[model samples]
Target: MYRIFIKPTLILAAIAFAASFALSHVNKITRGKIEERARQQKEDALKAVLPPYLGYTIVEKNRKATVEGIEFFYSIAQKNEGEKILKAYVFECENPGYSGIVRSIVAVDEKLTLLGMSVIQQAETPGLGARSKEMASNKTFFEVFFGLSRKAASDKEAVSQSWFEAQFTGLDAGKKIGIIKKGEWSAENAALRQELIDHNAVSAITGATITTKAVILSIEKGIAALKHVLEQENNAPGEAASP
Candidate 1:
């Protein structure tokens, strides 16, 4: 009895250790590539939202703050028309959602007009809350926000680029943004939807009210946190240095 039970337990322990070691080794090997891909994806998302600019500078790295356990990041876009004027300000934040944390980024012009928004990470229910992702054309929410470009010239084309995310553009951080679900949305009636758009209201995904609010809250919190930074930088423009 001892031989039979003890032998199997030892074998299982050895197998578990071997598997753990192998997984750890593989993770170490691929860590660099994974980080590179993530960095590239974020760079792409930042560029997708900001207006045409010569370049960008990261003013602050991503870090969690004590206030409400929120993590935030910030950047500044640059234009080359003449002196390198600060084109726009970009920021990111993570907030809790139905399934897990939802990460997002928002851009705004120097005058405080929203440029665009993109969902960086989420773990919500698939086909519902997960629809918040900002994927390439033909694979994201409504295809209005698809395609990876700085700007779309035509109104129709611009509307399609991350339609939901794009709606956040032209909005101001000072306003109290609201949510509108599809059950009440009149997609067929352009006028009704336009009204919602005009009022800083986000059109919610059917059956995903919680996730929609998560996005809204994340944006709001990001704006609040970023405002502190923006105010400080503006008040002390010479002290701040770009990353």
Candidate 2:
């Protein structure tokens, strides 16, 4: 009886130990490649956000950046001019969607002007918001935020907050960025609205308005957070001595 029980127990132990060894080996082999790929991917995303005319370099990682008074993690990318900056990409913000988090990489120039933004990940419903990735050239609803220009630093909220949040379009950094009923919008707003509508406005995936809102809010909050950091630095008076 003892011999019979001992044989089965030893077999089970052997199997468990083998499984653990295999898992550890896999992790050790893949860890470095996984980290390298992630870093390269982030660099590619940052390049997408910056204006075509400028160059960029990574400034920091895993730090907070804000938009529209909201905060999120950022990987700052900057363009150099001998020793100065010509453009910058502040943060790549991610927000929860209906199925998973949607990620966006936002870029601003040295003058603190918005350059462009691109979706990194989204699991929105198919045929609706899932089409955001295709909106830029296909006239879909989601492309409105792309190529959004900023005339000044303060204008970041103007473009990201109002129109994009409510799914409005043609908004610049100087616009009010608000929402109204279909007919209540002003002539200018009405014109912008129709343009978006014509663009197909990347229609919400029927039951996924919450996910859409999350994407917009993430961008807004990210911009707001970075703005706060820049403000703090500007007020510090002596922190500029070093990079």
Tens digit of per-residue lDDT, candidate 1, span 1-243: 768998899999999999999999999999999999999878767766764443555554553444446445676665554665666677787789999999887887676667877887889999778766532243334454665533433533443345556667667666888877644332355675677768878777667788889888987887788777666666785766544
After best superposition, candidate 2 residue 179: deviation in angstroms?
9.7
lDDT of 1 at 176: 84
Best by TM-score: 1
lDDT of 1: 0.69
Per-residue CA lDDT of candidate 2, range 185-219, in tens? 22345575676445434233244566556665666
Which candidate should be chosen as best, given lDDT against the real structure? Answer: 1
